[model samples]
Target: MTDLWADYVDASPEQAEALPARGPFGDSPALADELLALVLAGGKRATSGPPDPDEPVTVGGHWVVSDGSDRERVILRTTEVRAGRLDSVDDRFAADEGEGDLSRGYWLQEHRTFVRRVLGLSATTDVDDVEMIFERFRVVWPPEHADALD
Candidate 1:
């Protein structure tokens, strides 16, 4: 399992090379700031409901993809950045046999609300930068996802 936090990330080469250009959304710097705000506000967790008042707010990072089964493979991991560390509870959200996927619902709900309210997750940004942001800004529970670390 990966450590609770990491100084370096083991990212897919494809993800390591990703970089997205600005789009119709607006300025890249502003978008980055907003993302930073969200990251700092609550990290990058996908929640089933509103977060706890006592829960510490942090930044989270991950790579999401629809697997061949069409299930969302939400890779939740920790990050180390100048700002601090971060990770999402969604990474900690667990599932039972034949149960619905929380990560799928979590991201879908988060994106819907984000698009309708908070804007978008990114504006044509590269994957590796996202990775770096994650590596630099993520916070997580190390014991839950014990298999993802180096």
Candidate 2:
């Protein structure tokens, strides 16, 4: 899986150019929808679906599709995030331990765009370094929700 992930990430034309990236991800990172609910629900009730008013939704970690509803709930933990990656597909933790899974759809949507942008930037900028180019791509690309060019 690591190899596959590496292959996908390395294939980015941006990764091929080597550009430097600068900036902080910022507060209130993006959410993956249902996963946030499970963490806050707590216990067995911590499955996905419309969240309970008492629970605080967390967008990280492994999740469960509710008992009767076809929704997923995630388990939030402070140690499950890395950059934009989730620690557990079911646990939405903060990214400080190492590389968490960065395959969430929201992240992918923007990342794909960033890759394309980097290619264009590297092809035009004074910087020909692929890695550096990928870095710059992240800034130019829009958020995943901005996936639609509209």
Candidate 3:
């Protein structure tokens, strides 16, 4: 992680100093690798999670992304952040997540299961009102391809 950050900072001297990394993604090794692949491929430009008020995401903040093994592989600059109930996730945001057919229904179903698992909620627990923080970012390190979608 330190080496990756050093390389990025050295290459982009004008950008702000690095912030601590937020994730390798997902709750397990396999899942983390899967999501990281999507981000690298430019199929994923957004993600969401339970709100972290103490460290709210800010636009222009650079983030280091790692693989399941905790080795940093990419840097992302946040472009947007939104907070709302899980029920408020929209179709566009779902597509930006780049998972499961790029549909809102798939997102909801998958996230509902994910949220329940990570939070230790019972399968029957209602999560519609859970607070969520949605974030959109762009790959800024190693540079993105010209054809990569924004």
TM-score of each: 0.21, 0.17, 0.90
Candidate RMSDs in Å, in order, are: 16.9, 21.3, 2.3
- Reference-based lDDT, each prediction: 0.30, 0.25, 0.83
lDDT tens digits, residues 1-150, model 2? 133223323644444433222111211223222222322322112111111234333332211222123232221111121122211222221111112243344433333344445345443333212221111010111122111222
Which order, best to worst by lDDT? Answer: 3, 1, 2
* Angstrom error at residue 54, model 2: 50
How many Å off is the CA of 116 in candidate 1? 12
Task: State each candidate's clash count.
Answer: 19, 36, 0
Task: Write candidate 1's Cα lDDT for 21-138 as tens digits.
Answer: 1111112445434433343344433222222234322344343322233332223332432221122322333121011253545543433343333334454422212211112222
Report the candidate with higher TM-score, 1 versus 2: 1
Error of 3 at 48 (Å): 0.4
Please tell me which model should have the higher TM-score, number 2 or number 3: 3
Residue 100 local lDDT, model 1? 29
Q: Cα deviation in Å at residue 125, candidate 1?
A: 24
Candidate achieving higher TM-score, 1 or 3: 3
